[model samples]
Target: MLRIKRLDIFIVKSFLLLFIGTFFICLFIFMMQFLWRYVDELVGKGLEMSVMAQFFFYSALTLVPVSLPLAVLLASLITFGNFGERYELLAMKAAGISLLKIMRPLIILVCFICVVSFYFQNVIGPIAQGKLGTLLISMKQKSPELDIPEGVFYSEIPDYNLKVGKKDRKTGMLYDVLIYNFKDGAENAHIIYADSGKMEMTADKQHLYLHLYSGELFENLKSQNVKSQNVPYRRESFREKHTIIEFDSDFNMADASIMSNQATTKSMGTLKASIDSMTHYGDSIGRQYFKEAMGGAYSQPSGLSKNDTLRIAEANIASYNVDSLFEAATLMQKQKIISSAVSRTGSLQGDYSFKTYTLETNDYQIRRHRIEWHKKITISLSCLLFFFIGAPLGGIIRKGGLGMPVIVSVLVFIIYYVIDNSGYKMARDGKWIIWMGVWLSSSILAPLGFFLTYKSNNDSVVLNADAYISWFKRIVGIRSVRHLARKEVIIHDPDYSRISDELNALTARCRAYVNTHPLRKIPNYFKLWMSVGEDNEMKAINEQLESLVEEMSNSKSVTMLTALNNYPIIAVTAHVRPFHIYWLNLLAGVIVPVGLFFYFRIWAFRIRLSKDMERIIKNNAEIQDIIKTNNNL
Candidate 1:
């Protein structure tokens, strides 16, 4: 049996606290984004508070799966980041605990979250989506609240346009009102001008009642007896006129069944079933279309047997050229034949176009169902993937609080969102396979998560700038020169006689090596790669050079110390083969491009080696001269 330690408990508690807080933050952000997309539909409609609350509730449920992965990423980052910032992670590691052990508990929690994410995506998500869709459709159909502003024609009403020059807000009365009623038709519209009016909705909220005082009405008359050029109209003046306009302000919830067939409103099982049914349906439609085309468009004509039609078609093709026949025909006959062929071609085209549209619609539905099925699994897996990435990254970065972690988390989430959305569109439009598109983001990020985990566990300086800079410099053959400062305290003075003898030996060795190697010429390709041993002679020379410099650093003479610093730090084996293994070198040489790269690299190193040998010989001579001068003093 495994026991839970205090360390695990502490980590679990810390992650949970952050997870809960960050979950709400992420959900709110996603909800706001979702709401913004449909703001036009929801705004200006006189929806009740309870209806709005239901809309929000269903929207939140639908967005839970998307929000969970981001929450996991952010929470893991902050938890591990705090542990690293407080040096708690270091302390645990120092106490003989591995990074994996510290993370085991949170890993379990994240796994549980992943399962919950799947449940929400597969079960609760579809139902909420259906309800939300229904609500949005209902909201879109509902009429806007009645508010007629001054100096603008209000056409929100069904068949009327009313303009008010001014209005009394307290008394709810309009002034200088002009109304155009197009109930019958635009040509026979009734125009009314009122000096003052009061508008109110009926108790049923189904009609608007407009009462105008001192108004004149002009009504166009349409009569069968009247001539078209001389139309009659009716004009009436009244002290007060009341007109009833039809307008429904009441909100009616749409039927949930309207959105029941949508792909997003289906569970995983339903999606699979729907996909199977749609596939069969699409296949049947395609076969039917092919059969129809064969029978109708390319079939034998009426009263003609198959053999007879085939013989006739063959004879026509062999005996006559259609262009020559057309040229021989009369002009009217040619025109008639052309018109008949064009009509037949248009009919076939239209028939096939309709068939193609039907098949495409079925295929589109099948793709959507397939995409949704893969999405349920991909989003759940993303929760786990994100935690692995965030936990390892936080430990690597070693920064806590909202600032750095938030920025990193947002940047990472943006990349995931972009890739995921692009893949979704491609898959939705049948440009990519559904599984590949839905899982694109996860596949791309999985290796990154694994790499970060490996680096964090091994305590690698993966984020260190200086390490990358040094590697880059080495790759580009940019050498670094030594800068040695003179030491204030010397325990022992240098022996000029002993140093003089060593310097002469070193100078002779450098001269002999440079002459034997012939650094100015290119090395033998086969021997350079197929040979495996390092440049042991150069290695020994470098070692001996460093030893001499160490002993000479205690010299009292400034010129002697300066000469010691001038000896270059050589890359001992770089001028030889690329690697120590013969097989790797063989592989590199067998591949022409890689061989050429390493060949040029070796040549460059050879040139640098020649320069280094020259510097060493000169420095040795300077030191020898300095020692003689000190001896003379």
Candidate 2:
């Protein structure tokens, strides 16, 4: 007997419940989409309920493979996100449970799901596909029961167009009816016009009886003589006319074997066999084409003697240049030769076109079969891939419910869907190899799964905005310092009145300098735009602030010392400011985009510096006030 842990049971219970709901929800959505594709065939045809039921059943089975992976992805994401959101994950971690250990039960369940999905894909998917395909064919071939509308030409019947200007809804009476009967042939059609008419079905529903009042009939006599080039027409006017039109309105089922050879209808074994056979056939065709393309060199002429053949083979093609020959020929000879050449070219072109069409069709068919083979396995494996992706992503985000998880899942799946669809199309169109295109999404997303898993396990703050901003500042050579004292330090209160006055003066001077700064003008901006140079103005302010902070840290009051310590060391950089290279303006004008971007960066930096100086001045004033109060005490 095997023992199961309570933790495993608890986690499995949560995941299973969510999985069941999500799977059914996904199935229902996909089935609705599937039904929409054939709604035209299913509706308005009076199809038997049994046939409709059969279609829906098969459609559900066919859609399972597509829906399963997405369901797993959503369920796993939501489950983990819930754990993280409720701090269940934190409690588990506190209990010495690693994320992987906590996820073990759910992981096993997901792996089991993947295996079941593969079984369905390999065993059941093909049969369901076959049944659905047969249903589609039957629906297409089954002639729809007639329901002719007014003001539209009805061409449902073979080779005939029936039109009625107005239809009486209650009495089934048609007014101003015209029928173009092209059953004999379009060129030899029989035209009939009536002021009023009534249509009725025969008891067996095999034929339609059209009873018209006050009608004229016109018949083309060309059908009587097959050799007749000219159409002889006969018209007759009658008070009453009756016509019997043959139309089969029965919902007949088509043969299932008609769709057996398609990619969707084949089992894995059958698909492999077909691919092998097709590959061999393609190779044979290629060899034959190559032989033909090798021309007369490899295929000897039948009438030539050995010596004559040798001479012909050795002869230069330029010696018989057609252009020169035609130019030198008499007018009559040239006309005859040109006519013969044109006729021959037409025949060859037609032959090549037919051959090209055949080869292209075969090539695409082989690609489809191979793609299907890859699809069966890849789609099954996607269940596992998606789980890893969504679980780790949810863990990292620590957001639950439909709000964040749903948005993130949708975005990730959309990216995969777009890449997958594009690659499949490229492969199908012969722009890429079948396997490479089929696995393109997997290739990109598999690595992403690994990365997310690693980050989640290590608790990396990969998505933190402040971390990224700090990194960006560091990369761009901007300097900063954090203030955290290793131990408590007491500050001795000193010259509070003088310090306050000096702080006030510093703020005033900094403000004044900012407003009167030479680099604040447009001409200075243009100069900076063309070159990168150091600004002594902001540096002077930063140095002055730094010196004042150093002086303030020497106070004996602990509160004042701590308050001063809380303020960070500040530095300003004008990354895109003016430089001393006069000739660089010419280069800046040459590359307008780079010049403008650097110019903007510098301008923004200057503004930030101006703000930073004012903030520093204000912060210093507060420190001075704190020191002054402590000194008075």
lDDT of 2 by residue, 1-633 (tens): 123388788888887888888899889988998888888776667677888888889998988988888888888888888988899878877887777887788888888888888778788988898888988888877787688888999988887899999999899999999999988888778999999999998988788999999999999775467686776899999999998999877777888898888998787899899989888887888788777756623566888898987898799998888788779999999899989989878977886788688788888888998898899988888888998888887777778887887788778878989999999999999999999999999999899888888887877778556788888885464657546343455455346677777677778878877778743444354555454556676577667666666666666556766766655454455534434565665566457796776676666665656666666666777787786677677
Please list the residue runs of candidate 2 whose C-alpha ends up more than 4 Å from where it truly belongs after superposition: 1-4, 38-44, 151-153, 159-198, 211-243, 288-299, 302-311, 319-336, 464-633
Which is the leading candidate under lDDT? 1
TM-score of each: 0.80, 0.72
Predictions in order: lDDT: 0.90, 0.79
Give a tens-digit lDDT track for model 1, residues 68-126: 99999999999999999999999989888888998998889999999999999899999
In candidate 1, position 160 carries an lDDT of 89
lDDT of 1 at 528: 77
